[model samples]
Every structure is written in structure tokens, then in C-alpha cells.
Target: MSGLLFAALIVATPFLLQAVSPGDANWGKLSEISQAYGAVSVPLSAAALAGVVASLAYQARQTRIAQEDAHRSTHRELILLALASPALRPCWEPPFVPMTSAEWERIAFTNLIMSGWENAFRLGSLSDDQLRLTLRGHFSGAPARMHWANARDSWIELVEHGTDRRARDFARITEECFQAAVLAGPGVQAADYFIPEPTNGAGGGGS
Candidate 1:
């Protein structure tokens, strides 16, 4: 039986038994028996009730603490993931380009997109073509993409076209994207899409 119910029974049994007892002409003996049972039942019931309440409260507190810890752990993992990403590094360092409001907006949007892409890749839901298409859409008509593409064309042009610091910054962003694609896990087939196949003696080559 449940502890609460058992405690209730302990408290009630003495009174119930007393009520049903055949009373003698003498009231003293009856009073003595009643007092003896009452003394045991009252303390037992109170102790049982206190124990049940304390156990319940402790369990609730533990559950709350576990949930809070899990939330903090997940948050910490996400921060680590962001730091491991190559894209955010340039923004943190100096010869700092003061990003205009528009540039910052684009950077934020791109980072958000990259995060989603990484998650999708990890979950085995992203395709190379889809990744390429999404990137193309985001990069179109933006300084971010223009800067990146210019850096990819040639190191000499990259140095000549922009401030040395900006060129280095663009290189880091490009490298981060490449690294993300490679490290995105077994679900991603980034090499097929991003990396070119070595030419074979035959006309056709495969990655």
C-alpha cells in the first residue's frame, strides 16, 4: 500500500478499534488503552508524512537541476562549434575592417546560413547540389561573395585589389567554408562538389 494510505490506516485503526470495543463499566481501563495507541499512532503518522513530503521535494529539485545542466551543456557545445568554425576568426582579430551596418547584416545572415548547412549535413539531409545552390543564392550581388571570389582568383590579385588585412580576412573566410564542408561529417559529399577530380589519361575523370 502507499505510504500515505498506510499512515492514514495506522492513525485510524486505533480509534476505529476503540469505537468497536465492548466498553466495560470501568472507564479507566478504556482510557488507558486509548492513550497508549494514540501515543504510538500520532508520532508514526507524522513521521511518515514528513518523510514522503521530503522525498518528493528532493526529487523535484534534482529534476530541475538536471534540466538546467543539460541546457548549459548544449549551449557550451554550440559556442565551441562556433569558435571551431574558421569564418568568425577574422572578425575577432585586428587590422580590423570596421564592417558597415550592411556588411554586418550580411555577415550575420551568412553565418546563420552556414550553421543551418552544417546541421543539415550532420543530419544527412543536405545534398551537394542543394548546398551549392543555397550558397550561390546567398552570395549573389554581395560584397562578401565578391571579396571571396576575388581572393580565390589569385593571391597576387588578392594582395593588389584590397588592403593586405582585408585580403587575409577574405582568405580565412574562404578557408573556413572549405573546412566546414570537409568536417561536416559522413553525411556530406562535399569533395564531389567542391574539390575537382584529378585528370586521368582517359577523356573522362571521376572523383
Candidate 2:
């Protein structure tokens, strides 16, 4: 509304001046000045209109971004609730793994963490390198590794069956992380496996 008013004011200012000035003064000079002002005002009005259009475009884009963010947040919350609730156990619980309640909880929580990471990646929160590094560090641990080992096949099947194509690359990334963890061998620290070399041109190394 303010933008429309401002544009209207820009377009109307010259006419208002023509109406308000002394009517007795030199009409010839006033006519020339009015013509000059009109020439300048034409461009000014065009620029104002362009600005209004650009502003509307920007606002629309922001609204879309907000809506997408809200949707992602709501979706993430629903998934978490379903995972934690006993009522939804049959929906996602791994049947192949015969484990204690505590172990199953850990596995489920690890899957939740991976899902969150994948969601962030899909939302452009994490770049390829960032996601890779994060997964490498995380999956280096035994619990995360165990969870991925049991869940990888199902995740890959989902990707292959046209379930959320966005997670397709994520499956590959996590698999790479799992493979790297295996190659690092037992008892190898995440820092040692994922960050083996010195950084920032420093010669110091990790134990």
C-alpha cells in the first residue's frame, strides 16, 4: 500500500505543482519548466514502478521460502514423534535386528539423526563437503555404524523405488562414510580417520 502511494505521489507531484503555483506569473517560462519536469518525472515514475515490481517479486520469494521452511519443520517434527512413539513401532522398527530395548532405542535415535542431516542437506543447509565431513565424523562411532549397517539396504530400496529422490545422493554419501569407517579399522579415532592430515598448512598431526 505504501509503495503504491509513493508511486502515485511521484506521478502526481508535477501536476500538483502546476496547479498550486501563482497563476499570474510568466506562463511561458512555467510551461517550459513544466515540460522539463515532465521529461524527468517520466523516468522517475518508470523507476518507481520498476522498484515496486522488484519489491513484490522479492516479497513473493521470501514468502515461498518461509512456507518451505515451515513445511520442513513440521515434517521433521512428525517423523520424530512417530519414531519415538510406541504406537508407530510397527511402521518403522527393524525386524531383522533382535536387540534389547536400549539398543533398539539407540539405533532408532541414530536413524533420526541421519534423517535430520539428510533433511538439512535437502534444504540447502549443508553443502556436499559439509555433509560428507559430518557423516564421516558421526559414522566413525560404533552406534552410528551399526545403525547404518542395518538400515542402508532399506534406505537404498526406498531411493530406488521413487521415494524422495533428494535422498538418493544422501544414501551414497552415508555409504561412503560407512566404507571409510570400515577401512579405518577398529579403534581408529574419528579425528584420525576423517581428519588424517594437518590443516591450514600446519605440520602437526593427530595421534
Candidate 3:
């Protein structure tokens, strides 16, 4: 709006000068001033336009990020809901060996946690460093370690054959963190897990 007003004022300046001074000498002077003003205003107008374009591009990127965050949040909510309801469990719970009902629920719960981390990593909510740190902390306990041991083969298969590169990277980083935690010993603190090396697109065997 300001740019348009500035352009309008520039356009009207010559006419205003002509109205105020009707003589030929004054008209010649007005023409000279108009030429000089046009030269200066052209660059200024271009700069204003560029600024508008840049602002619009920034807004678009922010909107995209907001949408992605909302989508990730919705996914997390659905996972939690599934965890709470047995009927919904089949929707997300992966196949596993036969176990007691209590054991199945525990395994399913752990799987949801892992899936949530994977989703966050895939959606850009968790940076590679954040994923490594969080996964190491999570797998520092026995339950998470047991869950990964049960699920490792399928996850490794996905990393080897899945079309999604982001998922593959997530699996590799997660496996590295899990392995680091294992090497740190069962009762070690999460911080005891060694800093992960660069991802090698491979998974480690379970103990």
C-alpha cells in the first residue's frame, strides 16, 4: 500500500507543477525535475517491490513449517489414543512373537514411543543430534532395549529396502544410539552412551 501511494505521488508531481506554473519556462523546469525524480524513484520502487517479494516468501516458508508441526502433533495424538484403547491397538501395533497380554501391551507401548520419535525425525521436528540424544536416553533402560531387540529385524529390513530416505536415516541413527546405550552397560546413565558416529545406513545386532 505504501509503495502504491509513493508511486501515485511520483506520477502526480509533474501535473501538480504544471497546474501551479503555466509559463513555458516553468514547464521546461518541471520536465527537468520530473526526469531527475524518475531516475531516483525507479530504483526506490524496485527496492520496495523486492522487499515485498522477500516478505511474502518468508511468510510462505513459515506457513509450511506451521502446517508440518500441526501434522506431527495430530499424528502423536492418534498414537496416544491408540495406546489407550485396545480396539485401536491393531491399527499401529507391529507384529511380534506370541507373548502374554501384559507383555503385548508393554511391547506395543514401547513401539508407539519409537514410532513417535521416527515420525518427529522424519517431519523435521527432531534434528539428527536431538534424535540421537533422545533415543540414547530412551534405550538406556531395559524395557526399551527389549522392545528394540524384538523389533530390530523388521526395522533393519525397512532401512535396507524402504523407499523413504528419511526413515532409513532415522532407523540408522536410532540403532546407533541403541547400540551405544547397550555398550554403556544396563544400569549406566543415558549420558554414558558414547556420542554417535556419522550414520552408516546399517543396523547393529541385538544382544
lDDT of each: 0.55, 0.77, 0.78
Clashing pairs in 3: none
Model 3, 57-160: lDDT tens per residue? 99997897699669867877876786678788677655566555565566667877788788788879999999888987788676677778889889889678
TM-score of 3: 0.52
Off by over 4 Å in 1: 1-28, 88-207
Give the distance in Å from residue 9's predicted Cα in candidate 3 to where it truly belongs. 18
Ranking by lDDT: 3, 2, 1
Cα lDDT tens digits, model 1, 95-200, are 1245554454444445444545544543357655565555544443344343333334453355457544533443444455544544453222223335666776
Ranking by TM-score: 3, 2, 1
Q: Judging by lDDT against the true structure, name the best candidate.
A: 3
Q: Write the per-residue lDDT of candidate 2 for residues 1-207, one digit (tens) a residue.
A: 999999999999878977988878787887899899999999999999999999999999789668867886776676567667867766665546676555566677777688778878876798889998998778667777777878889988888786555678888888987898888976343345465565585676688
- Best candidate, TM-score: 3
Candidate with better lDDT, 2 vs 3: 3
The superposed Cα distance between candidate 3 and the true structure at residue 81, in angstroms, equals 2.3
Residue 201 CA error for candidate 1 (Å)? Answer: 42
Taking all chains together, each candidate's TM-score versus the true structure is 0.31, 0.50, 0.52
Counted clashes in each candidate structure: 0, 0, 0
Off by over 4 Å in 3: 1-21, 26-28, 96-132, 146-175, 183-207
All candidates: CA RMSD (Å): 18.0, 11.5, 13.2
